[model samples]
Target: MRKYPIGIQDFEKIRKENFLYIDKTQSIYNLIASGNYYFLSRPRRFGKSLLLSTIKEIFSGNRELFKDLWIYNQWNWEQKHPVIHLRLSKLDYQKLGLYEALSIEIGILAKEQGVELESKHLKGRFEELIRKASANGKVVILIDEYDKPITDYLDDLGKVEENRSIFKSFYSVLKDSDPYIRLLLITGVSRFPKVSIFSDLNNLNDITIHRKYATIAGITQQELERDFADEIAEIQQHQPDFLGKLKSWYNGYAWHEEAERVYNPFSLLKYMDGRDFRNYWFHTGTPTWLVNIMKQNREYDLENVHIGENALSSFNVEHIAVIPVLFQTGYLTIKGYNSNNRLYKLGYPNTEVRESLTDALLSAYRNVFPGNDSMSVTDDLSESLKKNDMPQMIKALDVLLSTIPYDHWKAESESIFHIIVHLSFKRLGFDVRSEVHSATGRCDVLVFTDRYIFALELKLNSSANVALDQIFEKGYLRPYQMDARKKIAIGINFSSEKRNVQDYLVKELE
Candidate 1:
């Protein structure tokens, strides 16, 4: 009956209260030994706050807390530094404004350290606090969620710029106060451009994608098996594929291309506690702004996205890219990388993110609320596919398409139709491949169920007979001839005027 630290980010509490603590102290020690100034960008609930908390305790000379940890006897415990920890997410910035809220936070830190600040300005106060706190020794500064104040106001350009400017000026103090700082680590969800926040403080080493520190925050597979063997064994008794299923549901996050994949600790802990596979991490918050951005760009094809290092690294308020935002926010993760071209292949980290994000995107595209209208349509579609009910499937597709508001049809009719169909099938947990290539030709969509394989060709403002003829003429089902499942060929046509499925033909491939 070990206590899982679900939602608990305090290291002292987890250690003192006998909670299950995954020892990440080895990586922490390596981080401190390697550099003094570091910046790490990880998605929310991926244990960024907990990492900072652990570091805070270590610097505060809490040697007893690390009695059984890996770093207990690795180094000298005599050296202690004053820790100035600030979590931007906890600051009342929305109500007090960024400047005032930050001022109050820093003032509180100074009071805790019994140091007096004579400066009235935010930047001056921060510098004064650091210098005074380091009177005995250099201060270890840890700022968690460093970009929350700006990211929370993304929809409002005026407020975003205002907060960005405030942070720029405030953080610049760190550059001149380097002598008083023993170590600095800033963690955030998004990496704003250096010019925005780190232009003056250019010494901060960004370990977000650094290979050595990639597993510094998340729970690795090795750590999972070693730390939670008892819980895993208990779950394995009933479900033979418990570990595999857990990996597919909660693992596959990789910051560096060559690093070992890590699981979302929050989701993993929840699954272990309840012995149920659920989207535990996604339910905590919905990325409404991210969904809106994807919808605006008509970018639904999220798998196998290829981008260079520069495009995947950082973004700012003036220019925001979908892939970087997706990568930074945990919707996507590094799957592959080409060193020659310096291109990274990004995709959904695991089943939880893939399914949950697809549901969100599909709901937004179809203008239907999730679990209300979209869920019924997708469930019906899934049931129809499983039963080989062609007419019912077509009806479900028509209903799904018809729900979209007329004004939302900005993209080309065929493209929009393909996106909706692909998303609908994906939302139902089907294996769907869009624009699949074959030897002779390319199929519009290929769907695979447990007992059936569907090769679909789509035509816009054309006859279903022509579409069916092309599917046969091109031999689209040739690739799946040995798939062992019942192979079916489908040709569908849509009318721009009707804005729904006009007609379709289905044929069983021998």
Candidate 2:
């Protein structure tokens, strides 16, 4: 049996070589039937390229590959049309400057179809191809990774604008060529089009948050069990805890309002191949341009990333701005959406994403938390909680905080503390949150469990008495007093000049 199409994105390559194809043909049928112009935003390595390649196959009229798939059974293969397949990712996104890159891609498409037209740039050549493709009849246009170039220059506004304008002109041709086009499917990770690249194409439909097509790209757990069932057993037997490990490391993506979650298909299969589940997804694919977003917004909480009473609808990209980047480049995702509220809440989709994010964070910071450090923090935490050794936890926290790498510490101290403590508790398998706000005021750290909720207030230089006074005066404990389970308020002060605790006050609410 052929290996699954783990990284292969070409439909022709996968089918011609007889690779295992995840039958996402049904989604293709629905997508095509629903609209003539559609766009989808999904994370990196979630099979957007493969999906586009499959579309290319359908339009190229390659009927053999579809024979057993759902679309083959359903689509009228006889009605296939000429296709204009433009995959932007195949070109060098970084090296080829914008004008040059788009021009080359246009040349490639023309060359592929034997449409030899000499044009200086994309607009003129693109016009010629659409005109030629239309002479025979309307054509199917599939553009893959449409925003890769713009994402490459996000740090520089001028370059981003320049590329966006170039893309806008290039894609605007599609609108003029629309009457002669049978269908259009544009694939990327975001729907926010800041440059107005697709402004001329008003009929475009964005299925980025559409629940029905949620499983269209990623590997659903059900698909994993059905198609790669034996592989799971193979790994599980070698390590009794493998299934749990796999789930912890590679599962949990919530793209659909209805579907539970999914794993990064690319990472899962790669791990299955090597019998080692690691951060494969981060290794390849577009470098996290989202890091720019995180860096720009330096104080974002790492803990509340995937957990809250409700999903995070706090962010949205401007359609003409670099919005398409996050959607196409694959950092943020449409997790749960509320049509009534017209909101899209985004977060990590699976275990692969979370672990990969942790690794990426460390890499981005270029510093690893000492393994022994986490143990020391835990031991100190236990001493503070169980033995009322507040000074010990405070002193340890000061040392940890002071030793923080310059890159991570460059962020706000609050943000740094949140990242550090959250990473620590994440290793301990507890849900942690920083900056917990109540109606009256906010607590610094809050850890919730089935039996207890710990409300903590940290003061780096303030007196312990002042910290304790604020807890009561601000009514931090009042909010949790009504809970049946216990709630504890901790007031700790750190030495302004050293890695030792100045004082501490701990209290329990009735």
What's the lDDT for residue 3 in model 2?
80
Write candidate 1's Cα lDDT for 1-510 as tens digits: 889999999999999999999999999999998889999999999899999999988888889999989999986788999999999999999999999999999999999999999999999999899999999799999999998888888889999889888988999999999889989999999876455788888888988998998999889999999999998888778888889989999999999988999999999999889988888998798667788788779888788999998888768667678899899989999999999998999998999988888888888887653444366657789888999999999998888777777876653657777888888888777888988888888888889999999988888898888889888899888887888999998989998888877889999986
Local accuracy of candidate 2 as per-residue lDDT tens digits, 91-130: 7756877678777777777777777786666788888887
CA displacement after TM-score superposition, residue 402 of candidate 1 (Å) = 4.6
On lDDT, the candidate that comes out on top is 1
After the best TM-score superposition of candidate 1, give how far the Cα of residue 118 lies from its true spot, in angstroms.
1.0
Which has the greatest TM-score? Answer: 1
